[model samples]
Target: MAQSSRRSSISGPSQHNALVSQNQVVLYNASSKGLTVNYIHPACHTVEEPDASTCPYCHRPLDEYNHSAPQAPTSDHRAPNYFHLLAIHNESTSRPLTPPHLEDEARPPLSSETMAEGYFDAFFREESKLGMGANGSVFLCQHVLDGNLLGRFAVKKIAVGSSHKYLVRILKEVRLLETLRHPNIITYHHSWLEPCRFSTFGPSVPTLFILMQWAEGGSLDDFIAQRRGISHGDTYQNSASPESEEAHMTKAQRIAAFKARTGAGASGTSRPANLKAVHLLSTDEIVSLLWDITSGLAFLHNRSILHLDLKPGNVLLTWDPNVLIPRGMLSDFGAARDMLHQGSRTGVTGTLEYTSPEIIMPDPMTGALRQTDSKSDIWSLGIILHKLIFFHTPWRNGNDDFSLLEQEVIAYPGFIPDPSITSACSRRGLPTELLTLLQSLLDRAPGRRPSCEKILLAIEEHK
Candidate 1:
């Protein structure tokens, strides 16, 4: 039997079957007005095929057409005007066909303007609160299209306030996100400005809503906490409501809690006695996670952008059914800065624990605080690597004490884990190359630390 290779299947015999059965080429122009049957248009035939006969309808002779040319069908036509050469095959031969509507998959992503306030509420249904931060909250949402569940997404709602500076900052982050396109980086979908609903900044203020790809496995911070059997408290709770736990607390209570969490009022750094790592990652798993992070950091550094905050909390994870461990992707660019256009401001930037020594302590030569650069990120990466291996940072004091942390960074030597931690690493079969890379990255002098490119090479070697 003969069939139109790229068109609808022929179920029963028709008047065109005579030509089709002979394995001859045929073109049918399907239009809104009517069907031009048994006509081979000049535009439809190619030089590779045998010469086609003249079109009986218009009396126009067939001309050689480059079928591979990048030309789309005219909009007035209901379907394709040209068809491929008919081929003869057995009637019993069966093959699955793709539906025509599936072509819509190639359409470009929806624009932010098209997804303004009402459009978002109509398509996305909020499932649960993923996490809450000081200025923003993320929610897990189910995206629906024509009554069909498409997939899950993460919607980040940040309070913009009435200040122009805050609004510009949010817009800047959106622009930064739009320019980024890497597998290890979080994918940005859509963003829009809407009236603030949950903000304490009054109803007149606007909120910036950013739609991002959902990371099913959660953040690395939560992942590590879970593996170590550590409770993340309300801030990291997946089931916490949109209203934060501290929302109802009095101003004084909030301040007191913040002080305790930051180790501000505490005498010195101390780990909870009950803290223990129950499920530890193997050497291969550690290398794989670090490789993803290093690749992402390299991509950013190559473009002259710096991820000021490189803590585990900013690194999201997604699991693949085929892979054993979750894949890490860099997210949350709120603190990211473009060194090209922006001037460096020296203040405490990013989380206290993961911050670089140069950003914390004054320069020994000039007694002046230095601005953060790419090397600062390397120091933070070293901290993350140490955490992945030992399930805790190298610091003896707790993370929140900035004054003690400054002292710790100033007196920091090379990688020196506790005896118990050393034993744990030995049992995990940690590689010598990784330890070498870690030591180099943790160099107290910013000039001494390796670049992201060097770190990537070392990670590749470990792999």
Candidate 2:
């Protein structure tokens, strides 16, 4: 539950959902009915955009429709005329990958045959909300027959009312997940389309279901919050709830006690059983966790996959199962891309705060803006490192959005970790090597950043 709260929310401050990945690209027309569109990149899955006609695969316009497009789909069961135009739009734009969503030609694409409603009704039960995205909701699922012994899974469901592109992106995500196999990445179990059997509203929307490996430990942010005894909402700040002072004080006292027990103020004290943050984790262990991420990234890059978004929330944490230890794994391929098909784009697609300087900047030759490459992902990884060690972001310009934009533009390789981290690390003579490595990783120029393999090696040497 703690992990569920700290999404790198793409939506506005007032909005949140369990399923949506980020804010949907809402398109409104006062003259005509408002049309809202949100899609996983049709081919690359790099970025989610507003209601633009750009083909996510080629990053161009969907100029024409295919002759044999599926009829407009209706949310109502087996209905007509409801989604005809959406079908045309999706079918026309959806581009198949080279191996067509497979690692190699030996494997075939997963069939689009959706699972029937009875399967879910009989097997799985909703335990709680996991997370939300622009177009869907994710739930913690429990197996009815197996109890908790078999472990749990997260199931994400997208409604049929979403734009045709939205559904197609999900289809592509399923295919992509099927192709990917890595220990540091979220494991995809099963995905299928199912009719909503429970909703009382107008024609039941066809829902896309993706069952994923449940990282019971939650996201990286959540793990940090839990280890630090920090509240999920209003983090790295005064997170006291408006409801009661006693509970807040109790939490504060617990944190203080935890810090005291862990001896975070001392130099290289032994790790406490409950402590899991900067104080407890060894540089070796931390790098090992980082190795998990880098290995996962290497796997993606090897397959020509680019995980455009690499924030704390996107990197999930699961229990070791053998023990309570937290192990890192990458999740949420909604913003992932297939580099084999689409080249970098000039448009910015990720969160502004974590975005690299080069992503929003223009190329010298093309003069086109927002072109990002693998190095962009490295920049994001640098920010996550800052947060992990410093307990805050390096770009602390101000609270409002404008300041954030300013920080993204001017923030550079020279910026160090927060002053708090500096003080602590200075006392312990720690984070010295790690921060120095991060400087290279977070370089403003993409070409200056290190590759995934080198990062892993660097972490290994530091250990």
Most accurate candidate by lDDT? 1
User: In angstroms, how far off is 271's CA in candidate 1?
Assistant: 20
lDDT of 1 by residue, 75-179 (tens): 111111111111111111211111112123334432332223444454568899998887689999985433434457899988754444665666677778866
lDDT of each: 0.62, 0.57
Q: What is the TM-score of each candidate against the true structure?
A: 0.64, 0.62
Residue 429 lDDT (model 2): 50
Among all windows of 10 consecutive residues in model 2, the one with the lowest summed lDDT is: 1-10
Looking at model 1, residue 246 earns an lDDT score of 45
Q: Where does candidate 1 have its weakest 10-residue lDDT segment?
A: 82-91
Give candidate 2 regions above 4 Å deviation. 1-115, 145-150, 197-203, 232-285, 321-324, 343-346, 364-366, 397-403, 416-423, 429-431
How does residue 178 of candidate 2 score in lDDT? 57
How much is the lDDT of residue 374 in candidate 2? Answer: 85
For model 1, what is the C-alpha lDDT against the true structure? 0.62
Error of 2 at 30 (Å): 57
